[model samples]
Target: MRHRRIGRSGLLVSEISYGNRFAHRESANCARAALEAGITTFHTAAAWGHGAAEEALAEGLREARRDDIVLCTGVFWLEHPGASQFGLGRKHLMSSLHGSLRRLGTDHVDVFQLWRFDHRTPLEETFLALSDVVREGKVRYVGTAEWTAEQLLRADALANELRVPLLCNHAHYSMLWRAPESQVMPAAARAGIGHFASMPLAQGILTGKYRQQRIPPGSRADNDERGRSAVRPFLDASLLERVDLLRGIAEEAGLTMAQLAIAWALHHEGVASAVVGASRPAQVAENARASGVELGIDVLTQIDQLLGGFVQSDPRLTFTPTQYDDL
Candidate 1:
């Protein structure tokens, strides 16, 4: 696996990270498969499967006995309901970090990210709490996920002021979701913060399996309500035809449709990793090989032109209008 440094920090992660957000129940097996497939990084969350994901990941890593790998987890998703239960407040952050550590069966995680930007809490409070954990030997690096360009800048500055530089800004970047490129990716690149691309396959639509208006049995579009919702937006016949055309491109590039999608997401200097979920070992192996695959400028341009209108680019759509305005 090829390694990329997270932002300007010494922390390095495999270009392709195995994320267990969707397959938390099978994470132990998935983690083992990931390590075998040369994936050194694992992305999980505090509330994934209500903490089952972290524990399962720990089980797999323990069985593998590899502490030299990067383990990344996040805080948010309102793990519980309480006045002080959520957000980036010190109380929640400190307690959340301890809970994550205990569940992962480790003293610390390599990257402890603010999974959501908490407008309710001061950015200073968030960074201050993050800095304390770094000093307490609990978290090595701090990052953000799905934050806006403005929010990224504000938090990055606050983190620097606290002497705990932010490492990466992970966001939803895929064949269909290009909104981050409007401002988020450039901002992170300029700030020397790495960008982690989540959902690089556009929730499986770019994999070509959803082509010809046929949703395969047991696919995300079939089983998961949330997954179905994510995949529903691209179900138009014209868009499905455009997605099907990617099969020829993938063949010409000597890549699978999924691999082509992943490579495209990683085809930037600022993007450090593509976080993907897999259900089986074979799927993990296939996704791992796309880490270092390079695409030419011609291929990129063709892709951009093929899926023109279906792609999302508006920065305001990053979240709700009211929420984005507040950010």
Candidate 2:
């Protein structure tokens, strides 16, 4: 697997990091497979399965060398204390990190991210809490996910003010969703922050498996709440037609729809890593192979035509909850 540094830091990660949100049941095997596949980076979120995801990942890493796997997780919610497994407040961030470390059976994590942009709290307050964690050695790096370009810039400014290093932003950017091309990607590039594209598969929509009309049994689309909600807005004829066209392009490229979809995400220069979640080991290997496939200019141009080329942010054009506020 190809590896790259996160942001401008010396910390290196695989091009395709293993996403642990849905790998809970078989996390041990998943981690073993990832190591066999040369994927050393693994990421999870506190809100995913309400901490079961991280716990599973911890269990998986037990069999692997501690230095071989880089672990990360985010505080999922910043609302009421009950809303999140760990709120973003100083107290909550510390308490949550300790609990996460204990669960993972580690003293420190490679990266700890804020799962969402908390509009309710001052950005400084949150950044400060993260800075404290870094100083105390509980978290090696700090990052954010699903935040706007403006919010990311402000975060960097705050990090600078506090002398804390802000590493990256985790967002969803795929052929079906390219909102980051306009603001998020450019902002991260300018601020010297890495951009990790989460959910490059669009909850299996880009895999062409769903074109069969029904979600396959045991697939993320069939089992996860977010997966189900994400596909709801795209039930219209226009979007479905677009999806079909994109699938045709993938066929011409001699690639599975999954390969084309993942390659489409890696094609973006701003993306430092693409975290791929798989339910099975074979699925993980398939995604890892796409790291060798790169789309040339001609294929990318054809793809642009199918994807409407430009970033479209009409709230009316959302495909899922993750795509809802994309702009």
Candidate 3:
């Protein structure tokens, strides 16, 4: 697998990072397969499967050298009883990091990210807390996910003030969703912040597995309520027809539809890594092969033409408002 440095930081991550957003049950096996396939970066969030995903990954990485893997996790959301229990407060951030470390059986995560933009808290307070974690040697680098262009700029400025590097931004980017390309990508490029393409497959819609209206048995659409909701928005017949056209291109290129979709995401200059989640070991192997597959300009143009009008590039699609205004 190809590795790229995140932003201007000294750390380098695999171009195709393994994630455990929906692969809770088989996370261990999937992670192992990814490692075997040369995927050095693994991403998980504290809220993913209520922290079970991290535990599974820890178990999976038991046989590998700790220094060989780049582990990433996030804070700002927890499975607590009350609403105030979450956010970017110092208490919550520290507690979340400690909990994640214990579960992952690691002293420090390679990267710790803010799962969401906590508008309820001051940016200074949040950055200060993140800076403290880095100083304490609990986190190597800090990052954010689902943050808008403006939010990223503000955070980067604060990181400069605090002498902390806000190294990466994880945002939804895929063949179907190009929202980040317009604003976040340019902003991050100018700020020297690498972009991690989360949900690079549009929750498997771009994988060509769900061709018709019916949800496949034992698939994420059938098992995960949130996954179903996320995939529901792109379930139009016209979209499916376009997917069929893309499949032909994949075949001609000697690639699976999923690999073509992943290669498409990695084609962008600003994207450092494409974070992909898989439920099976074979799927991990398939995604690993797309790491260095650079599409020719002709094929890239054809993909854009086929996906015309189907690309969802609206910035508002990734906007997340503050949950608590009073805080």
Candidate 4:
């Protein structure tokens, strides 16, 4: 696997990073496969299966040396009763980090990210708290997930002032979702913050499995309510039709639809890593192979011609507004 540095940071992550958002039953096995395939970066969150994902990762990497793995987790979305239990507040962040560390069986995660921007809280307060974690040696680098370009710029400035420089920004970027290219990608490039592309497969849409309105058995949409809701928007006939066209191009290039999608996401210079979710070990192996696969310019143009109009470039799609109000 090819390794890329996150901006100017010392951290070098695998081009294809393993993420455990769904937290499948074979999570440990899949993670092991990722490691065997040279994927050292593993991403999880406090809200992912309510810490079960971290536990599985800990078990999967139990035999590997701690320094060899780049474990990443997020705060701002823990299971708690009160409103104060979420967001980037000092109390909540401290508590959330402690819980994550305990679950992962590690003294420090390579990167600790805020799951979402806490609009209700001042940026100063958030950065101060994150800087404290870095100083205390609890987290090596600070980052954000689903934060907009503007929000990332503000946070990066604050983090610099606090001496903790925000090193990464996790956002949705896939063959079907090109939203980050418009603003987030440029902003991260200018700020020297590495962009980690989440949902590189568009939640399995680019995998060519959900075609002709047929949701395959045991698929994410069939098994998880939230997964179904998340992918429902892209189920229109027009989008699927475009995917069919892209599939033809993938076959012409001697690649699977999923491989084509992953290679496309990594083609951008601004994207340092593509965070992919997998339920099985085989899926992990397949995705890892796409890391260094460079598509020809003609093939890229064909992909864009087929999918340009279908791309979801809305900046607001980065994070849900209701999440803040619900908290």
In angstroms, give how far residue 248 of model 4 lies from its true place.
2.3
lDDT of 1 by residue, 1-327 (tens): 899987888888999998887545566788889999889988998877778778888887886554678889998666643333776788888888899999888898888988887877788888888888889878888889888989988887887788885889888888788888879888888888898899998888888888777778977778878778878887889999998998899999999999999999999778899999877668899999998899999999999999998889887666412242322
Clashing residue pairs in candidate 4 are: none
* Residue pair clashes in candidate 2: 230-320
Indicate whether candidate 2 or candidate 3 has the larger lDDT: 3
Candidates by TM-score, descending order = 3, 4, 1, 2
Error of 2 at 160 (Å): 1.3
Number of the candidate with higher lDDT, 2 or 4: 4
Residue 279, model 3: Cα distance from true site in angstroms: 0.9
* Deviation in Å, model 3, residue 76 alpha carbon: 1.5
Off by over 4 Å in 3: 81-84, 324-327
Clashing pairs in 3: none
Q: Model 2 segments beyond 4 Å from truth? A: 78-86, 309-327
lDDT of 4: 0.86
Better structure of 1 and 3 per lDDT:
3
Clashes of each: 0, 1, 0, 0
65-87 per-residue lDDT for model 2 (tens digits): 77777888877453233444334
In model 1, where do residues sit more than 4 Å from their true spots?
A: 22-25, 80-84, 319-327
Q: Write the per-residue lDDT of candidate 3 for residues 266-305, one digit (tens) a residue.
A: 9898888999988899999999999999999989999999
How accurate locally is residue 278 in candidate 2, as Cα lDDT from 0 to 100? 77
lDDT values of the candidates?
0.84, 0.76, 0.87, 0.86
Ranking by lDDT: 3, 4, 1, 2
